[model samples]
Target: MDKKNLKDESILNHDDYKDQHGAVVPPLYQNSLFTFDSWDSIDQAFDHKTEAFIYSRILNPTVKVAEDKIAALCRGEKAKLCASGIAAITSAILHCVRAGDHIVTIKNIYGPTNKFINSYLKTKFNISSTFVDGRDVAEFENAIQENTTLIYLESPASLTMELQDLKAIAQLAQSRNIKTVIDNTWASPIFQKPLTMGIDIEVHSASKYLGGHSDVVAGVIISNKEILDSILMAEHELLGAKMAPFEGWLILRSLRTLPIRMRALMDNTMAVAKFLENDERVGKVNYPGLESFEQYDLGQNQMTGYGCLLSFELLTKDIEKIKQFVDSLQLFSLGVSWGGHDSLVYAPIISYLKELSPEQFDAMGINASLIRISVGLEHTDDLVADLHQALSRIA
Candidate 1:
């Protein structure tokens, strides 16, 4: 178990833990704790001074493999895996903000993130927050306070697909001496690299794309070495929200095929987005890939690829007709998460409205009949036929 004696430190490696059978994939280390050869070794691990993983709660060989691959994907100094996407996000926010700290964030990020900041932190901690339109750098500048410690953002902001200029925002946050964090889950580090733009930190809901099979629910934080260490101490070790070894194994398998899966997913997405845009029944398809999108140029400037998620409101606002359309779909599954081989559809009016205030809803134009689709690896022709039939149901 000596680090200096290792031959290769590839993403597929589990340090030097060689199986007697010479297996290609590392064997899952499912036990809760590891035995020490001597009393000094145990002391070294507990002291936060040793790289040796002593407990599954803190670290495991299988989980470490996934973490290493994620870190490499993000081009980060380090990475930490968590139980769920919220675990990764909440931990990063809580770790960065102490009581009385202020946060300025984009209006439409992931719903759970909005709830965590507006509801949970507002009630328990004295952290203050201001939500703004991130598409305008001036809004971010205007929202900053003397106490502002963090600036959080999500580009192609959740369902609405509003684009943010990451490089400009990062520069603004840097000049203000404020920390910058972003949810890069939508682009999956395949199409966008936030860290390279001078952003301080990036996070992902590994449950969606990283797992790629709709099986494991996991999260990750990719950032500088110092910030990761701080989060590891506060949220990871103290809260005991580490990913299970078995789940880690599944994610590793998914990571191996991520590149190919993402290529096919994007191709399907482009095809589907075009089909939705051209349809007479569809209104305001919110995909950056389309030249008709308001921020299409901005998205093209920052993102290397058009991602797999898009939302559109029906020309008809009847809720009953919308339900019929959703229920009639064959290829796309009705579910919450995506990045699997199977496509998914969800109504934000059903879940997202519960979190937004009446005034916010009015300002944002919360279309009751809107539909969001997470494109998958399905053949484009078949997926289009499934969607066309669903639209026919509504008519």
Candidate 2:
């Protein structure tokens, strides 16, 4: 069946095994191991010839259901559930890049991801990477070397909200036989599908939109069977970063409401973005929905909806003034992370990188006046009103 039908017909509507009570929701199979009827049955399962659970580390019925749902959502042949988004990203890269291999990445990727490749991976595995401004696909091509094994990117990058051309980059990677992976957390499958543009693999922090409520912390790596097997065989089993059964169940439950939640959040976000754009205190708004945005045409072409997350730089790069603005907001909470029912506001503090000097901060796009706001499910009028009061106090 086609992907949309697979999602709507089987994956979305499908239910896990239930007890005699006929409970609709899947119960958490939280056991570490399952008992086998016989040695023959165990042997068959070990040989991959039967559908039986040997151990939770290797497989769990609940986790498998969630993996299948996300795999379908990503339009990949297979998917693997991981303890966290970083685990998925780490495993995916490690599985492909051996010692002496190289990777090219967009500069504005998540801070931890940058650390992993540049610092952690380099020290431990002798792997090296080049960071480039991925807004220009040529930068990726220019950075590629003989040993370049992978290209990693996060479009509409988390803090900067910069959009990358997935199709162009995927095609370039294809010619060089290099694998491509994207952190699709910002624009969930509801907004963008990387696989359709020929990306080799897709990764997500299910902790964000996929989990929806910010209650669960999980990650997913979706790819074809070949890459999935190599990853699972190489590090997935040995590293033991698998998601728990109950966490997987929670993600499955979250999937049903993803479309609805995303729609509401986008509606709220569009209104808020417009409010910020019109405000004189806000010097610049970085939302794809805004007509004045640099990549507005590309966003309209590639994304289904302008995502709920956006960033803005204030007219005055005053730290105390920015903090006061954020603090005065009664509706928005000052915290980390997004894709929750409650709105969050993050100032351009040093929470991203500890040793990042003032020079480094200037090198990156962030400044003291810049702040990232994640629009939640709150009413648009209330959110706008709160933002108005906060900005009014700034002057």
In order, candidate lDDTs are 0.84, 0.85
Off by over 4 Å in 2: 1-4, 7-10, 13-21, 49-52
Lowest summed lDDT across 10 adjacent residues in model 1 is found at 4-13
- Candidate 1, residues 95-149, lDDT tens digits: the string is 7788888999987888889989988898899899999878899999999999999
Q: In model 1, what lDDT does residue 90 have?
A: 90
Clash tally, candidates in order: 0, 0
As a whole number from 0 to 100, the lDDT of residue 372 in candidate 2 is 89
What is the total number of backbone clashes in candidate 1? 0
Error of 1 at 300 (Å): 2.0
Error of 2 at 25 (Å): 1.5
Model 2 C-alpha lDDT per residue in residues 1-395, reported as the tens digit of each score: 44356653356666655767898887778989988888888888888722357888767888988887788777788898999999999998887788999999988899889999999999998999999988888899999999999999898898888888999999999999999999988988878889999999899888888888889989999999888877876678889899999899899888888888889999999999998999887888888888899988888887888667889988886677877888999998998888878888987664744567766788786765778899999899999999999989988
Q: Which candidate leads the pack in TM-score?
A: 2
Off by over 4 Å in 1: 1-20, 48-50, 353-360
Local lDDT at 184 for model 1: 87
